[model samples]
Target chain A: MILKVENLNKSFGGILASRNLDLQVEEHEVHAIVGPNGGGKTTLMAQLSGLSKPDSGKILFKDRNITPLSTHKRVHIGLASSFQITSIIQSMTMLDNILLAVQSLQGHSYKFWAPVSGDAGMRETALNVLENVGLGRQADTVAGKSSHGEQRQLEIAMALALEPDLLLLDEPTSGMSKEESGEMVRLLKKMKGEKTILLIEHDLDAVFALADTTSVLVDGRILATGTAEQIRSNPKVQQAYLGEETA
Target chain B: MFKFLENLPARVYLAVTALLAVAPLLVTLGSQPFYLDLLTRILILAIAAVSLNLIIGFGGMISLGHAAFIGIGAYCVGIPAHYDIFNGFIHLGLAISCSAAFALITGAISLRTHGLYFIMITLAFAQMLYFTFVSLDEYGADDGLIIYQRSDFNGLLNLENPTTLYYTVLVTLLGLLYLMHRLVHARFGRVIIGCKHNEKRMQALGFDTYRYKLTCYVISGTICGIAGFFLGNFTNFISPEMMDWTHSGELIFMIVIGGTAGIFGPVVGTAFFLLLEEMLSGLTQYWQLIFGLVLILLVVFGKGGVHGLLVWADTRQTAQAQPENDS
Candidate 1:
């Protein structure tokens, strides 16, 4: 397994965000976590990404416990996440955004005298990452001026630049239009076998299309885990989530 | 040459540097020695503003206690000079180290808070330093201290000469401006700018942003401290008043007036502020009241200050010229 979560628990004030949440993601498999609104999908992603601490649980990445690691430290050890609400440096160019991720993985960024733009190798690497996300043509476009769909692509490009072992993508197509969503699915479909992605997605079509394994989360607990066929047939998952949508 | 001149801000920068180079000669020819002193003072404060811009303008760190470094730097010179130590190197070393140390310690705590709280905590630290300096009666306290002789460079350069001092200050400013240019384009600079735009995103991108910001804060303080070293030599006076929050506010005003986006903006802002202060104070005692109104109008209508106006004009010219080229 690339990732293992054991009985993870988190509560905010009086509400429980995660309760005895257990999950496992296999190497090079696209694992999708699907649920209704506020079903603790993001909370589980947050805990796994080291953005928040679980009150009672252990998170193991590559079989080593990473429950107490900070967000940046987890990233350094090959775990990178993309936010649900699309977090990117708006004032910089799309290429520059990816360059930041590339720079981070290369070495310490205490280099003050030499200009980063002059580093031809780093620029090429960043460009290649952008190209992989189909944003090579818009490399010079300021991120804030880019279309929402383009920004989402840039966001994934940034996370991919880290070359992480496991990618935690939270609702990558949340704010995208139908065409944009199709483009995103195609992009992810290309990376399906090569990358281990723990995806939290709302789009059922996307989940069925991309996910190698699907897990149903309900009220901060895993209701069921199976293939698309089994998940669609599972009575518990259908009653808790899929049934609500279909009905 | 014409193509180079097409860039308005670059042209202005070149013209300003050339004028400053000949300013001392001009003052001598006009027999107005007072203008030399005024220009020297402006150059010194411009250095401070430029340093502050590293954090405020570029790094998105709005520190309200930047003048504290100036005060600390001045004291580094004053305290040693009091005991008959005239070594320029020693004074500079102390100034840089002391200011850097102070910034590191304060920044460690202050950077943990964001926005208004960060501003408040920084102000509180400066006030703390101000009071500490005021209570030190051994170093003249609230009354201040004086240096009988300028820092001795052992005949390398003469601070005793007004013209020499002006050139020295000018060289320092130019060197710093070049350094700032190099810095903002470097890896370190990109990280700082990224943090400014979105700290959380930067963190997610595997950057330990707090450490980068703290390092930037220290760099800004150290540069400002160097400016303070020059200020002590020029004014020949060191006092707690030098670090008053109002003085820090004035530094911010200078940066805002010139423009914050460009590396040279603070220098232009400093010049505008001092020259306007000089002209208006000569006209009336209520110069500050008029200054207040002008600043209010500038902030309200002029979004980018003087530098922004220059950029706007440059872009317009480029747009107008584009059609001619196409035709």
Candidate 2:
């Protein structure tokens, strides 16, 4: 398994976020987690990404436990995530946004005297990542001024720049229009098998189209785990979740 | 309604800086030692503002203990002179190391708390240093210490001559400005600004933002310490007054008025503030009252600052050119 969560639990003051959650994601596969709102998809992803520590659990990635790590430590060890709300450095240029991520992956940015633009190799790599996201021409555009769809794509491009072995995508198409959503789906579909992706998405169409396996998370536990075909027809899953949404 | 100076082109900024570089000639022609001395103080203070701008303006770390660094630098000069060792090289080296060390220690602890909490902690530290300096009876305690001899550069540069000192300050200001400009465009600078804009995002992308902020803070202290060294040479005095919290607020005010975004905004802002204070003080003993009122008016009327006004004008001009496309 590329990722394994063993009996993980987390709670707030009075509410449980993740309750004895256990899951596994095989290498080079798209694992989609779908749940009703507040079902703790984000909390699980957070624990895995090290945004917050679990109350008690072991989160193993490639057989190495990473539950004790911090957010940046997880990133340094080939795990990267894109935020649901687009955590972008808004005041900076789009190229600058991606270039910062690129610079971080390359190592410490202690080169004070040399201009970032003067490094032809790093600049071209940043530009290529931007182009892949279809933001090639808007390289110099201020990130905040970019359209909502562009910002979402830029968010992923930053994660991609890390060259992570595993990518955590939290609602990659949130707040996007149908057309923009289609573009994002196509992008993710094209990127499948290139790396292991743990996708947390609400769009049922996207999950069905892209996921090799779908895990139904309800009340902080995996209700069912199966292929799209198996999960679609499973009476328990439909009665619990798919039935409510489709109803 | 176009005010020529208000709507001046970008090139005029360079011209104004150039004009200040030769202001010594104009002052000497007028045979005014007082104005020369005042302008020299402006240059030195401008250096501190520029250095402060590196962390506050670019790095977005609102440090309130900046004057503490200046005090540390002044002591580097004052303490050595008190011991009868007046070498320029030794003074400069001491200023850099001591202030940088203070920044490192204070910054490590202080950077852990951000925003208003960060401000208060830094202020508390600065006040601690101020009181500590106040208790040093060997350095004249609360009264302050006077330098009997200026830093000797082996007859290479005369710190004693007012004209030489004024020109010396101007050149240092320009040189430091160039170095800082180079810095803000560098990769390290990009990380600092990125962290300011969205620290969580920067960290998630794998940059150790804590170390970056601490480094910027240390560099700022080291640079401000250089300004302190100059301040000691100019005034021939060092005291706890130099490290007061109010003086740190004044440095912040200068940057705000000049627009911290541009490379020379802090310097330009320093010039505006000190010149206004000098003119107002000459006219009235109640200059501070008038100055406070004008500063309030400036903050309300000026959006972003003087440099921001220029940026706004540039954007408006572009919008005018592409009228159909934008709106």
Candidate 3:
């Protein structure tokens, strides 16, 4: 197992976001969490990414407790995330955005005199990552000026640049059109087996297409965990989530 | 060569430097040495504004207590000269270290709270320093102190000469501008800029942004402190008034007026502000009323200040020229 969460509990005032949640993500498998809106999918992702502290839980990455690590420290330890709402430095170029992520994993960025733009190795790595995301031609385009689909692609590029051991994708295709969603799924499908991915997705087609094991979450708890074929036929998962989607 | 000259800001930077370089000769020929003195004061404050721009413009740190560093720097010189210590190196060393230490301590606290809270906390720390200086009766208290002599460089350069003093201040400004250019383009600078755009994003990307911002704050304070050192020598006096909150506001005003995007913005802003002050104060006793109106107009209509205006004009020229070239 690459990630293990034991009895994770979190709440906001009276709203239980997580309740004795237990999950285990094996190495080199795409684990998808599907649920209705406000079913605490994002809340769980936030806790996993170290953005929010779980009220009670033990989060083990590689069998080492990382429950109390800061967000950046978790990233340093090879866990990176893409947010549900696309987040990037809008004023900077596409290449610069990826360069920042690549720079983070290399070492300390306390270098004061040498220009970052002059670092040929960093430039090449950033360009290669952008090219992998099919954004090679738009390297110089300001991120804010790019299309929504492109921004979503940039978000994944940035996350991949960290070369993380596990990638946490929170609704990567949330705002994408049908065509864009297909493209995103194709991209994620290409990344299969090569990466350990914990995907929080709403698109059932995408979940079935990319996830090796699908888990149904409802009312702050996991209803069931099984293969896509099993999840589609599981009565509890249908009544809690999938049935509502079809109805 | 032509392509490089086509860049508006570069051309302006060259023209401004050349003009300032020969300013002493021009003033002497006109027999108005007072203009040179005024220009010297402008250059000193311009240094402070440029340093302020590093934190505010590029780093997205809006500190309202920048003048406190200037006061700290000036006093570093004044207090040393009081005891008959005239070593230039000692004065500069104290100025850099003292201001840097002050910035490091205060920045740690101020950076914890962001936006309006950051501004208030920084202002509060500066006010504390201002009051501390004011209460020291031994140092002449609120009335301030007089420096009997300029910092002795042991005959390396005579700051006693007004022309020499002006040149020294000018050189310092130029060196600092170059330093700012290098810093903002460097790895350290990129981190600070990224933090400004989105601190949360920078953190998620694995940067300890607080440390980077604190380092930036210290560097800025130290540079402003250097400016304070020159101010003390130029005026032959030092007082708490130099570090008053109003002066801090003026430093920010200079940056806003200059167009905070480019390195030269602060210098241009400082020149515009002082020249207008000189011209308006000569015209009326209540020059501040007119100045306030102009500032309001600039903020309301001008998107980027004076530097923005130059950029806009340059882009328009390029657009007009592009069609002719195509034809």
10 residues in a row with least lDDT, candidate 3 chain B: B1-10
lDDT of 3 by residue, A133-194 (tens): 88999999999999999999999999999999999999989889999999999988889999
- Residues B1-327, model 2: lDDT tens digits: 345344444555878787887888988798886888888898999999999999898988998878888898889999999999999889989999999999999999999999999999999999999999999999999999999888888888999998888888888889998888788889889999888888888889988889999999998999999999999989999999999999999999999898888778888889899999999999999999999998988778986777888788877876777877766
Angstrom error of the Cα, residue A172, model 3: value is 0.5
- Candidate 1, residues A1-247, lDDT tens digits: the string is 9999999899999889899989999999999999999999988988888788999989999999999998899999999999998899998999899999999998899988999899999999999999999999999999999999999999988999999999999999989999999999999999989999999999999999999999999899998998999999999888999999999
Residue A107 lDDT in model 3?
Answer: 84
Candidate 1 chain A has its poorest 10 consecutive residues by lDDT at A43-52
Task: Looking at model 2 chain B, report the run of 10 residues with the lowest lDDT sum.
Answer: B1-10
Please give the TM-score that candidate 3 achieves against the real structure. 0.98
Candidate 3: true contacts recovered, fraction:
0.78
Ordered from best to worst DockQ, the candidate numbers read 1, 3, 2
Extract clashing residue pairs from model 2. none
Expressed as tens digits, the lDDT of each residue in B86-116 for candidate 1 is 9998998999999999999999999999999
The candidate 1 chain B region of ten consecutive residues with least summed lDDT is B1-10
TM-score of each: 0.98, 0.95, 0.98
Residue B109's C-alpha lDDT in candidate 3?
93
After superposition, the stretches of candidate 3 with alpha carbons farther than 4 Å from their true spots are B1-3
Q: If both were scored by DockQ, which would come out higher, candidate 2 or candidate 3?
A: 3
